[model samples]
Target: MTQRFEYDVVVVGGGPAGSSAAYEAAKNGVKVALLEKEETIAETVRTSGVTWIQNIKEFGIPDDCFNPIRNFSFCSPNNEVTISDTVPRAAVLDVRKTYRWLAEQAKNQGADIFT
Candidate 1:
């Protein structure tokens, strides 16, 4: 016989938003299910993988997973400018690792993850 499971909340996609939602819901004792059509999470690359430092801290992303960028360069047909900041203003992430981490978090929180 096949077993059936019911969920109070169903989140589609295994991206950052979906994983976060499922994690929060399950952590709060809700029966949450996260679905991903991909064969594996983070298999597809959709984002530029750039995020701000504030967001990284706020989201508790690990430092090892990203590289800090304190300098930026802007170029035009006739003009080019470069600027650097004392503190890292942005970061470049390993998208595959980042998504996997988020999915792991959601799973650890009791969210049923389906890939």
Candidate 2:
């Protein structure tokens, strides 16, 4: 037997964009189903993992989750420069935890998540 689902929106992928879409739609009382291809939502992270301090504050994400690097060093073929006092900023993240958390949040908001 083939199971067919009827939803207001069928969202593919469980990344940041997909999570946000599902969240917003579900929050509006729309039927949403989120699909993720990977078994583990947050497995691979290829990012340098650097984001601005203001973004973290705006997003309301806690500092404890990130590894704060106060200084940034840039190395180019021509030159290298290091800046100090990049306060309250972070560069490293546990991608696995973050992705899992996002998936959880979407689920909690009544969005059916499938992997």
Q: Each candidate's root-mean-square deviation in Å?
A: 1.1, 2.3
TM-score (all chains, Cα) for each model: 0.94, 0.80
Return the lDDT, model 1, position 53: 81
TM-score of model 2 vs. true structure: 0.80
lDDT of 1: 0.91
Error of 1 at 110 (Å): 0.6
Model 2 pairs whose backbones collide: none
Local distance difference test scores for all models: 0.91, 0.75
Q: Write model 1 residue lDDT over 35-99, tens digit each, in one string.
A: 99999998896998899989988989888879999889999999999999988989999888988
For candidate 1, report its TM-score: 0.94
